[model samples]
Target: MKYVVTTVWKHPVKIDWQSMRQTMSKSKDNPHVAEIHWYEIDETTHGSVAIYHSRDAYEANLAFMQEHRSNSISERGIEMFPRSAW
Candidate 1:
């Protein structure tokens, strides 16, 4: 199944495009990730829609993120809503 995830967060400071780009680029390095659509909710708020090849892939992504970039994500963690329709 295609695993879908959406996450929204507010930066502790104003949005940093340089850091955001550098961070999001990590998705390209993970084979399990299909794609990611990022949105700028406002100057400090951001969101993303990430699609993974499988549930395991999504979980792996979470582990990797938690290990390498947990600070970038909200303390609440990523939000997921899985389905086969995609």
Candidate 2:
């Protein structure tokens, strides 16, 4: 199933691009995850969103967040929802 995972984090002074890339690469290997995509938050927004395909979207999201936090980044999981028909 397709899931939308919303994450919010304080904009760091420097975004660790290399670390972020590595974290994402690792997330791709998660058994529950089939695929993932990211989008930057809009200027008026406070966080970013990642769309992922997974058998268990919630678990996939938790794993992603945990990995990021373990890397010394702080992030909050805002929501997880199945794809809307609309």
Candidate 3:
């Protein structure tokens, strides 16, 4: 499974990209995670699209973000599609 997560930062001042990179690196320890692609959309927003082994993996990662980066998140969304359908 794979998911595309989009987030808009209302409190951009609270973000530290360096710290986020470290967190993502640490998250790789989860066997369900295949890869993550991070993106920067101007100064106030950034997000990631990740490949996970299951929905459980996706939810776990979302939970991790909520716990660690709650202050920086303004809006968020998740998308999943069958690979063959796409």
Please give the TM-score that candidate 1 achieves against the real structure: 0.71
Model 3: per-residue lDDT, tens digit, 1-86? 55544433333244567876986788678676777666766454555666676777667666765565643333333222222210
Local accuracy by lDDT, each model: 0.70, 0.51, 0.55
Candidate order, lDDT descending: 1, 3, 2
Residue 12 of model 2: what lDDT? 40
* Candidate 2 local lDDT, 1-86, one digit each (tens): 66665555444444455655775787667665555554445432244445556536656467666665555433433333233220
Candidate 1 lDDT tens digits, 1-86: 88887767666667778887987897787898898878888887777787999988887777775565454444534332222223
Colliding pairs, model 2: none
Against the true structure, whose lDDT is highest? 1
Off by over 4 Å in 2: 41-48, 52-86
TM-score per prediction, in order, is: 0.71, 0.48, 0.52
Clashes of 2: 0
TM-score: which candidate is best?
A: 1
